[model samples]
Target: MTYELTRDRVEHYFDRTATKVWERLTSDAPVSRIRETVRKGRAQMRDKLLSALPADLNGVRVLDAGCGAGQMTHELAMRGADVVAVDISPSLVKIAADRLPNTLKPRVTFASGDMLSADHGAFDHVIAMDSLIYYTEDDIRRALDNLGARTSGSVAFTVAPRTPLLMGMWYAGKAFPKSDRSPTMIPHGPSRLRKTVSDIGQLNDLGRVNSGFYISQALEFRP
Candidate 1:
């Protein structure tokens, strides 16, 4: 599938799954065992992402690119950062906006749009979380270029590892078929991802969390 089509599918899937995604982000008690596992895995990924942020976010400006359900966006605002949270799914964006506390509403600006094309102005930090898993290598490079232009300090994102074992698992999922509505993911290994961001800034490997079949690799780039 084309990148645009894949992105559309991802947006649709997330929009449909917005409520479940919110629960997964906030609550540990998922409806099913599989969902419980997913919750644990995503929590680990969030922790790794949070660890890479600046120690002091007081008055910091942040671009929460692809900020699904405002999970990280809320955290950033709580840390005293002024956040511009952007997501492609309108439903998810609305959910995120509604979930924000009344006091934090003033500190956050929620919008629905493609992160690469949006003009969110400048920020001290740009975080994409687990959102880049749908982008191809070229698309990822383009996104990094856009993010680098807006960020003055650092950019952080997560990608699914492209290892043989993980690729096998992905193929197995396609064979078994969980649901016909699942979104297509484009996995990128650490080496290729490092090269994609090298032109824009210095790449730092934050760490990787192995979540059974796939691995979530956290990376930060400093300009």
Candidate 2:
């Protein structure tokens, strides 16, 4: 599928189907054991993504692409980075803006749009956690190309690594009715992804995190 088509599906899934559940899942509210594991996994992934960046972020400009509910975005601003947190879901973006601490407001600009939009301008770094997992490898590379062009430092992103467990889950989830399914994650082989971005920049294997059903590999690209 083309990027725009995939983006439309993603937007519809997040905005119409999963917004409330996603908001709850990302919050402190009680959830089922399965969902709790997902929450834990996401937290680990966030930390892994953040650890790739510099310790001191004062005066730094960062892009929080697909900044769902703004957890990572808040963290970046807390560390003193000027953040433009963009997401495909307007509902989630609103929640992110509303949930942001007042003190951090001056450091963040929240918007509901394509994360790769050039209007958001340049950045010192970019973090795209759980954002590019749905795209094909080619689309992911295209996204990195656009993001890398605007970033002076590096871009940290995540992908749903193709593994036995994840592949099984993907197949099982396929049994669900189309009406009930959320946006499906396109699992990627690490080597293929790494090699595909060869000309974009220097790619680093940052490591992977697995917490129950949530599994993702983190990578950093420096230009």
Candidate 3:
């Protein structure tokens, strides 16, 4: 099935799978080999993102752009940072909001909107997580510019790396029956992404996590 990358479709895709997405990110027990691989890769990505954060986040202002289900949002808040979490899917935002602990409620504000257009105000740091995979190269650049403009410290994000093997796997996954692939899973190269953020900050290649056929790269931009 050919999947069209439309706003409505993207929202629908995530909205219906918000719970599953949350489980995939937070689950510790894997029922199958595929699940284990996915869990390990996601954990590595989350670790890389967290490691890039400042050593001291007490009272820090953070923007969790495209914070689907708010896993990182919760983590940041737990570290004593006030977090403004935003997502394009209303259901996902709701899921994130509901998942927050009562004490952390005051530290987090959940908003439903596109990160590229949302005015989340200034923040000490910003994290986009696995969100940029849904955007085109030009749009990703614009999003990076917007995020950079609102942060004083750094901006961290993950992307589906563009490589012959990964590109082939992406296509194969799309061609499979009943595939749960996102319509906007466009792969990007690290060099091209660096050029896009060149004017905003200095790019640091954090590293990459391999999950069988797929690879997710983590990058940080210091202003």
Candidate 4:
């Protein structure tokens, strides 16, 4: 078991949570709130990614794995990258499709499915933000391996740092706000993640997600 529950049940809980998140994401008030919150951090996130991103995103095909609400996916597409945003939550995918700009819709697609199970082909880039917190360490390692195999350029993601006390606080906060209902998963520190990436020998921790809440950024490649 990853946390205190099985993977199947965790998936189910997230599927349900996705429904509520989708409702908020689609509503005008919530969307406006998102636009405001994202505006504060989006630029930094984009800049960090671009620092390691391949120079040519134009006409490049990209995959946004675990693309909650499709915020980053839309940004990539808007920058001229053909994007496919994937999530295990169908309702979340629906909101992503709806919130996407009509002009960019042709270049951006939303899919409700597991990234590992999907038929996503080789891509120039793959991004996962605040989305890796749901998996066990073994699964995260395996997923990184698989993502590297599927992407030619880079596989990037943000994960919460592993500190027992910090994790406890973060977990408690998420629960207090009645935020996450999924099973608790172990958080990883930057050192642990760096070691994992080094062990794979295909990925490199080029940068980090500096939003200041125990998050790190990692990049991977296949030799």
Q: What alpha-carbon RMSD in Å does predicted model 2 have with respect to the real structure?
A: 1.2
For model 1, name the residue pairs that clash: none
| Candidate number achieving the greatest lDDT relative to the actual structure | 2
lDDT by residue for model 3 (103-210), tens: 999999999976656467898988888887766777777767777777888889988988788688678876866345655477889898888778767888999998
lDDT of candidate 1 over 153-209, digit per residue (tens): 888898877777767767776675545647656677778777776777787888888
Give stretches of model 2 more than 4 Å off: 174-177
Best by TM-score: 2
lDDT digits (tens) for residues 1-223 of candidate 4:
5532444555576677546754553344445544445444444665666556665578898888877667777778777888988987776777778888899899987888777653877787888765666677677787777777777777777665565665786578666533345455456665666676676646555565544333444444442
Local error of candidate 2 at 214, Å?
0.9
Per-residue alpha-carbon lDDT of candidate 2 for residues 1-223, written as tens digits (9 for 90 to 100): 7999989999999998899999999899999999999999999989998998898899999999999998999899999999999999999999999999999999999999999999999999999999999899999999989989999999999999889988988889879986688778889987887799888877888999999878899988886
Relative to the true structure, candidate 4 reaches a TM of 0.75
Question: CA lDDT, every prediction?
Answer: 0.79, 0.92, 0.78, 0.66
- Residue 186 CA error for candidate 1 (Å)? 1.8
Give the TM-score (vs. native) of candidate 2. 0.96
Clash number by candidate, in order: 0, 0, 0, 2
Instruction: Give the per-residue Cα lDDT of candidate 4 at 185.
Output: 46
Model 3 regions lying over 4 Å from their true place:
1-7, 17-25, 28-31, 173-181
Instruction: State residue 192's C-alpha deviation in candidate 2, in Å.
Output: 1.1
Model 2 per-residue lDDT at 205:
84
